[model samples]
Target chain A: MKIRESSALILPPYFFLTVFFILPVLIILILSFTHNRDWSQGITLKNYLLILDPLYLKVLIRSLIFAVLATLGSLLIGLPMAYYISFSNPKRKILLTLLVLVPFWTNFLVRIFAWFTILGRQGLINSFLLWSGIINEPLQLLHTSGAVVLGLVYGEIPFMILPIIAAMDRMDISLLEAATNLGANRFMVFKKLVLPLASPGIIAGSIFVFIPALGSFVVPDILGGRDSFMIGNTIKNQFMTVRDWSFGSSLSIILMVLVLLGVSAYLRQGRDQSMTLGEYL
Target chain B: MSHRDATSNVGFGQGKSVSIVTISGLVFLYLPIFILIVYSFNDSRFSASWNGFSFKWYKIMWHDGPLWTAIKNTLIIATANTLVSTFLGTLAALALSRHRYRFMGVYHKILHMPIVIPDVVQAVSLLMLFAFFHFTLGLVSVILAHASFSISFVALVVMAKLSNLDRRLEEAAMDLGANRFQVLTQVILPNIWPGILAGGLLAFTLSIDDFVITFFTSGVGSTTLPLKIYSMIKFGITPEINAISTVLVLFSTLAVSSIHLFDREKK
Candidate 1:
């Protein structure tokens, strides 16, 4: 009887998700195999072959480099930020955590756009430099590949910080005390105990930063110049401008596969096999 | 051990160096937004050098008819999306936590599928689906795209709330001879009401701020505020865009502060 009632409750989401998410994903997958939406011509490997071409391949490789750099930068910066909070007084911890989270709650595009003032040719750094006699000409800060990486790291730091903080909060404080008492020095305790214990969070944080950075287009499009085009731009161009739906679908499938790999790794690392929103906040 | 000595011995907090790094990280996160807000009021149009403060940009934004239309469309989409997603998402949370069903694990995976994939890919897929069905590109399509993505988020928040919920209240209500439905509606639902609200608020925020998915699914003449902001960008950096961003940041701060207050009051 309880099952009967519960099934009724479950039916809406199942139906809703089926029509909107699952079916759309299936359509795209099927669409990828067609010859530029001319399915009557039968399935072909043309789209996949197009993606493998060197001109497109450069974009894929460039995106990977940017993502990897952004992930590493986030980890380097976010680790210390998380450690400070995890080890702080209870009252201060809440305030500190909120400082990290405030940026996250705002508009993502606005955050990227915020950098425009600081990185534009006539922007902050350039104006300051000129006034101080540091440079005769305005330095080109915006519209560069480095600016894209900066936007990504800045955007993704909250994701990296919160998870590591959660992990550190969950850690056994006594283990660190025991190690110190057993003649392990400060460095040894961090290396042997705190760092190892925080490894799961580090992995989770890396996955969080890497996946979005990998698929990003807005930051690149806004901050980067023409040469800095990523795979996302390529896909968007194909679907919207070129109207090559088959090629775009194939690209989407590849990106989907890469993201799924990250999700599988996250699931494997997390003992609960799920990430809850409460923990993120 | 003294508090200072204990922290130092643990070696995680090297005190000054760690403090500096943490402060710098916070500054890096905040500095851009701060500059953006300040620049919103700058009188000069071209030079990055500030002239003086003015309300010119805000005034310009006020008279922009298209901006008003976008705001109307955005509010409608976000409000409706929140209602539908929160309802479906709360049911999903209840289903996962309270009841046993066949293929529950598979259903759990299905719920998370939207969240794990890239938004750009999700947008492309939905665009294809809508195009295949000859569905008109407009407000309705945008709502579907946003809701499909926002549902998992709502479900996750409510599930977190459920995990921390006490089941004995429901059992005691039943012991007092209340029907099962009464136990649920009276006991379980009331206890998790804050969680439901939190989920709703989150869904609303996601729908409002979403860009990538909305970019694809939205038809011509249909625009959200984020879409409006992007269109503003193509014309170059203006004080008007900064003004809009400042407003968005302030609004989000207000929303987030209320959530914290509500959560604290509940406790």
Candidate 2:
């Protein structure tokens, strides 16, 4: 009786996901191997082969590089802040954590757009420099690889911070004291004790930041120049502008596989921590 | 506990530099938003320059018909998606948490797939599905797509809550002659109400803020706020966009903060 009741309860979402979510992805997998203009031409490796060209390969490499840099940038900025918050009093901890989340609450597009006014040729930074007589000409700050990295790092830092803070909250502080009492300096203590203990958080946070950065379209679209085009841009163009669904589907599949690898790493780390999937998010 | 204090003191000794990093991190996070809000009141049309204070952009946004249409569409979709996904997800969570069954592990993994998949992949696949099925790309398709991904999130939240639930309450209610339906409605539902509410708010926020999936699934007339903003930003930055974005930012902040506060209170 209990089993039947449970099945009844689960059936709705099971059916919903199978129909709308799982089935769609399966269709995309099938579609990627077929001809774009005419499906009747049957399955072929053309779409996947096309993605192997050096031009497309460069975009894929650029995406990976950008994602790695963004992940590292977020870690550099987030670790200290999360460390501070972890040691804060309860009242201050909540407040500081909320501060981290405030930017995330804003529309992602708006946050990226804010960079435009700050980085454009005639924008805030340039105008201020020119007014202070620091430079005779407005520097090109927008539409560059550096600008894209900055935007991505800014956008993803909170994800990195939150998990690290959660991990730190659960840490055994006595281990830190033992390290200190044994005459290990702060840097040595962090390297030997804190860093090893927080590896799970670091891995989880990296997956969170890196996967999104890899698949990000809007950030690059807004802040990146032509030379900074990532695989996401290539995929977007394939679908929207080029009107090649087969090629787009193939690109999407490749990206999905990469994301799944990151997610599996996250899941493994999560298993060690006994964390629910929701907690990782 | 004394050892903990000793370690925390070590942390406190570095407080000066830590505070600097924290303060600067806060500034980095908010500077763009602060600039955007301040520049929304500028009399200039271009966002980069500030002539003087004015509410011209606000007035312009007030009269922007397409913007209003997008807002309406977004709210309608978000509301519908939230209601449907939350209901379905809560049911699934109850099933997963309250009962043990064969293939339960596989079921859990399947449910988590949507949460991990990239939005672009999900978007393109949904677009393909719609084309394959001859489903018109419109408000309905967008709502379906949003709900499809959002159900997983809702289930996850509710499952987390349900896992910690005291099953004794339901058993006690049943011992007091309550039927299964009454035990569920009176005992389980009230217990998990906060999770349901949080999941609903999350779904609504995600549906409202969704861009990638909506971009592909939305038809010519069913643009959402994010979609509208994307098209506008693609052209160029304007004070009008700043004003609209300020409103969106304010709304989302309120929504997300309320969820945070709600969860805190439950804890």
TM-score of chain A, all candidates: 0.93, 0.93
lDDT of 2 at A203: 77
DockQ (C-alpha based) per candidate is: 0.57, 0.60
- lDDT per residue for candidate 1 within A1-281, as digits (tens), equals 23334777789988899999999999989988999989699999889889889999999899989999999999989998888888886557778877877788899999999998888888889989999999999998888889999999988888899889888877777787888789987677777887888877888888889999999988898888888888888899999899999999999899889889877877776657344545673
Per-candidate clash tally:
0, 0
> What is the TM-score (0 to 1) of candidate 2?
0.94
Per-residue alpha-carbon lDDT of candidate 1 for residues B69-144, written as tens digits (9 for 90 to 100): 9999999999999999999999998888888888888989899888778889999999988999999999999999
Compared with the true structure, the alpha-carbon lDDT of candidate 1 equals 0.86
* Candidate 2: clashing pairs of residues: none
Q: List the lowest-lDDT window of 10 residues for candidate 2 chain B.
A: B1-10
CA lDDT, every model vs. true structure:
0.86, 0.85
